[model samples]
Target: MDFNNSYRVDLREMNFLLWEQFDIEKNLLDPTVNAEYNKDFIQQLLFHARDFAYNELGPNYQRADREGCKLLDDGTVQLPSKYQGIWQKYTDAQWGRLSSPQHYDGLSSPYIVAQMIYEVFQGADPSFMVYSGFCAPAMYLIERFATAEVKQCFSHKLATNEWTACLCMTEPQAGSDVGAITTKAIPQDDGSYHIEGGKIFISAGMHELTDNIVYLLLARVEGARPGTTGLSCFVVPRYDLQHDGSLIDNHVRCVRLEDKMGIHGCATAQLSFGDNGPCKAFLLGDRENIGLRQLSSMMHMARISTGIYALGLAGRAYMSAAEYAENRVQGTSFKEAFNPRAKKVSIMAHIDVRRMLLEMKSKVEGCRALIHKLTFHQSWLTNLQALETLHPEKSEQYQALSKHHESLVHLLTPIVKAYTSDQAWRVAELAIQVYGGHGYIKDHPVEQIARDVKILSIWEGTSFIQSADLMKDKLAMGRNSKLLVVYQDQVKTSIARNRKAGVLLVETDALELSLAIFVKTHALMGTWVKEQKLELIFSISTRFLEMMAEVTLSWLLLDGAVIAVQKLKNLEDSQDEAFYTGKIASAQFYVNNILPGVKSKAEIIAKEDTSALDATGDMFLQRTDLYGKQYF
Candidate 1:
């Protein structure tokens, strides 16, 4: 299991996304923000993050995965020795707190700035990120929702990475169906609850990297109502702090570990709480049965993080495929078959290879753009809230702006999470196809990337799950719900503005064309919602997500291409030329080849096929030979 430093970071693309596309400097300069952020800050951080990824994490990835994690007989999980040290080094660097608020001893760089670091580290080694990535968000929840005393106990340590945490949600019976969890919490006199239950597929649940593991466990309290409404969240730790300040065991047990397909370095454990007696847990704030509501925002953050993981691994796969195609010369050109003197060329020169590479590039970069775009919306919404807090006289103005950003973030979150993860697997598959047979073995990096990315679509939520959310919430057009319409208008405005972008004309047109289809399907979905056609809504929900994600990604890519077209004309350096050139190629290729699927998906949805709904039970009951012979 050899690892290669094949990860490529296009600083130019990062700059383009930050400066040209989003104008992030302008965002920071908003009167609400009161912060100084220039291109130099972004440029410096990009280089630093690149160095950190290549030198610190990339080298350890394969060794860690090969070594994997081990569960001792005593119910302790130990990461690979090398992987364990990297966590300490990572903690020392304080990179985990990059996106945390400053009051907790954090840098609190803007979301997009932090996202650059995420892409690098995840691409360099996603398993390593699996260990460190959730820390900030976990600390964020604690800081926001915990009691002052609980904050005193856990905030700094979790924020500084002196402590680690895991999210405990999935049970043996309940994976995505959070409402079905049976974890029980009994109340005690000391302001703690006795937790008793088992949770499966808890990543980083029982690791030795920290002094204690803080499990953000969801459990139902005694005599609560049923379903998610009855479920409350608890901050359950591996060990409890005694009155004398000495730590005592909390009776948290690692029941077993999942032998997973990839990301072997991160342990996914089955945890049992309070099998012998009681596991102490502090309620997350004073809330009861509002755990689902509280966790929803954090869950969205995790989903976005999952998509970032997909983008990073997909980018790495693309880089590996591109590098291999450049070096691995095999067959002679079919065009020069008659000429005996004709020499073999790099596979990168092959048209089909270019097509695959460009498709992967377009999807990865487009997904990155979409994720950052969502982050930008979230950041602006935060800023507007701050403005509302500071300037009461301008509350209405700030509220309006905040609503706009909120709508964009709400509408785009599912698209980023589901679309990016699904495309990542496709890109990994294409990367393998680009490498031919050599890609299937562990000798290359793409194979592991393929394995790792497969879990992402299933990790945050399944594709169908995300799609239903989109259809049910984002596109739901009631009295206060107008995101679908607003999003369509925004895309139309962009298309209108970019009509003059020379080489991007076709791409912009494609976006415009696809967006029209999206609007049509959106209207159809609204009809289903109005008509109370529940089955129709559920059936075409994923298709609706596809239409939404493809068109939105196409718009983002074409918007980047519009900037690239102007930059290309003014750039003196060939490197700048090449960078802008690639951006243009990615935009053109995606809109021409990929985004057209949005229209087709819309057409399919319009047909309102109910075959799956009408299928007989016996259709899937058994299988027979083609000759009508049954094995049984």
Candidate 2:
């Protein structure tokens, strides 16, 4: 698997994202973070992540995938033997607890570093990474909301990787529609509740690597109301543990394992609770009807991880295509006029191939920067209290700053998860095209990467869900007047920078038009809400998401250009020169080729396109009898 080389690329991207692009070190050194850790210590932590990814974990990724876990009829699941050693290595190294609290034998490293480690793991093999990655979020939720007793009993084990966790949310009928979940929890005399329900698509639901599996099950209490508001979250363990921490057989059962398209190594099990009897479960928080709100915290983390997955895939695809183009010889160059006996050159010399490669690099890096920046903001938000203790005088100022940062993070989350996944598919396809015939076969990694990245767009939340959230929650964060002022201020800053750089003049103009259209569209959306135009809002939500995505990405590219110019002036090394050059070229490519499309989409949103409203079931029915199956 060449773990060292693979993670070297991942680490390079991570470093570029954190220290170079976002200057996370500076943020960490702020009075808030300086009270807890120093810059050198943080750097050492990042180094540890690099070592773990390359030396320990990356080697077993492909082997684990090819030799997936097996489910036994006796209701036991066994992972590949190779993963057992790798999992142990990761746990012993405390890699699983990178984001956990320091009191629980965790490093409590910054989120940027954690995200960097996740990127390395995802690039190595996303399936194998789930064993620990899935547990981190569960542990995070417990740390944030669980009682002291519960934390005392489980936090150490989870942080030490003695137990793994799974988020049990989806049911057979309630995939993406959480309100329809029918899982029930009945209160018992012992203060604990008895949970009886079924959960499907539970990743790492039943695996042999841990002593016990902690299931963060979402269910409805008996006599509770319907919909997501009445739902509550329960902590259900696979095996009952005595007060002495000894295991006892429990009633939780694995009904079946799903045959998935990719990530075959991670067990996606269908779990049935209490078929034999009621299963003991403890509610997380004292408050009721807070299940969805509690779950939202983990949801954001999951979305971030999903974005990381897309970024990793995009990077892998770019490396594959770049390597192929530099080696694969094709047609003669256009500058062959100087030589009568011109020879074939590398495909990179061809215009179309170079164009495709540049486009992939541009989007990959742009999306990487966006995701990493969001992660940095989240880490800062999480650790702000710790920061406040160090600088109490400026605590109020920092709190105000954190509020704006939180809003920015919320606004960017959907875009990071949705747009990156959607664009990653295109990047993967281009990588395959660059390889020509070899790409379609298993000889190259592009086909697998393409298949793997497809899950990102559909998981966490679908692109539709994200787009709707952007239009509804993100835009409606405050009064239209306040949001407009903030947005206009941002636009003005970009315009100022653009006017100085003398590049992206056309893009700058296009951005202005896009923002104007967005304002009008937003006004229309408010009116629709007043008129109760739910269907119309639903119809235009997807297009609205696209418009926001384009504008945000364009702004990010322009920001990159501003930095690239500074680097170009002081560029010292060949590598830095090439990197900066690529940055400028990518930003230009995006502006020239991509940003123009947003105008047309904005027009559609402004006009309220409802073409789908007129479609009939018969249009999709079996027209083979009348027009043949090959009608297309």
Candidate 3:
């Protein structure tokens, strides 16, 4: 029943990921380019981040959800009582600006490092993170596509957390089907537009946490074409800003607040624009109909954020379960089962409990490894692009390499979002099982963690949406998609190198077999496309995505295991011996146990059974008598 800060993180594992596994020093922390984020500075930053999460964020997590947000009669949404103090401390610490550009009063930290810091914050209170997390992506949109005047007015405030932002794309009618949105924008004389429509499920839509809320809205200009192409992006503020930076009412209102299952501290408001009066805004950039294209970057980052959020929740659950297993004494150990006088041991001693904990551990670590690998590629791409700008003579070379990294990011983003999210739910379930009945109630954090992560797979486009994107867009490149080609090549190269290293032979063999299954399944799906079996392809799309994800995690884990084996020789007497040993065990467990499932899935896809597609509505009913014997 204790609610006092149950959040936990493994700093040593984080250190291993950054320093040993990913090798940020060789990859991103070069003094010639990224001098500011050397080891000392990043390590110090992480420690400070950990302290903030434990002290300021973790303690308020349960309280925030219990109190939720309050929508006042004055049309303003008030957050949990403790939120204001937490928000002030968070913004004052400049934690929001780590990945922001320096010109915008940010530190310009590497995206991977920022993500690690984010995992800490997210683990502490994902609902709290919901308030400030969208600001950076919104700022990026403005900085990249907004006009000089618009950027001048809004960029700094968003970057510095003086104001918060949200992407207003979802309507009640158009959830994932963004092309169906009916929000309207009418041009005015002074080069501005009046926005009219209602947006639903807008996170951080209406709150008193900041003086103003900047909305990166999407609407159709009058006389524009229908569907997604007609949509235009707008920078709509809740208030109008004067030259002196004062605010005037712009008629943006919170029409209603959703009553949700979890993340209650976040204000998911139904917003109305121009319902009561004029709602003025400026279009993003000079274009009018390229809103979807402009919003792609933000959506991409949001998907990545969803994955990180899932990882955070999963990591917290695993840590909680592990801690509980070590402390919660139950029945006697197996060895003492025959003796009534034998002393009881912790649940960690039970074989089934150990199995469950290992399942949680292997999945969490493998997913973290996958996420870090994705972000590392992103960081490398950013630096490569920057180098292209600085060194024009070598621009072509940098551009080519940047293209490869770009492919990696695209290939991994959907998988990260879908796979990590799907796994997080299972991980939370395992944590609850570890706690037995207590996990089902509010007394433990696992139940809340379970509720909070359920939406990750549903929102930001469903996991099925991500899967379709992967199958249709990512892997469907004409002769061969560069994303898939590069992905396979990189994974194959790792497998080959590890095979020569001679350690983890069984694991590497299993990974190699899984890779073949993935490649074959991918080829089979391509053939289905040619054969006009689009329905079957789409039906099995999620399974295909999971196949790719399992192979990816195995590749990275075994690659890390190679490093662990190499380091263990010198660290046998050091404290890191256990850490390195655990790394190998985690990799072995996942590759041997989980990677083989790819083969079974590949067989399922090959069968192409049309039962689900062929089923009649009557077959889905629970009551056979209602359909009569003939239908049965």
1-632, model 3: which lDDT tens digit per residue? 24579989888888889999888987677665668789989999999999999999999989998989888999988898889999999988999999888888988899899999999999899999988898999999999999999999999998988899999999989998999999999999999999999999998789988999999999999999999999999999999998886899999999899999888989999999999999999999998999999999899999999999999999999999999889999999899899999999999999999889888998999999999999998998879877877788999899888888888999899999999999999999999999999889888889999999898998788999999999878888223676777987898899889978888988888888888878888888778778888898888889889999999988988888899999988775688888888888888888778888899998898899998789888757645455475433
Model 2 TM-score relative to the real fold:
0.92
427-517: candidate 1 lDDT, tens digit per residue:
9999999999999988788888898889999987899999888877776732235787788788988888898555667667678778877
TM-scores of the models, in the order given: 0.96, 0.92, 0.97
Tens digit per residue, CA lDDT, model 2, 596-630:
77777766766766678777777786345554654
> Which candidate gets the maximum TM-score versus the true structure?
3
Off by over 4 Å in 1: 1-3, 29-36, 388-392, 477-481, 500-503, 624-632
TM-score-best of 1 and 2: 1
lDDT of 2: 0.78
| Clash pairs, model 2 backbone | 32-387
A best-first ranking of the candidates according to their lDDT comes to 3, 1, 2
Scored against the true structure, residue 349 in model 1 reaches a CA lDDT of 80
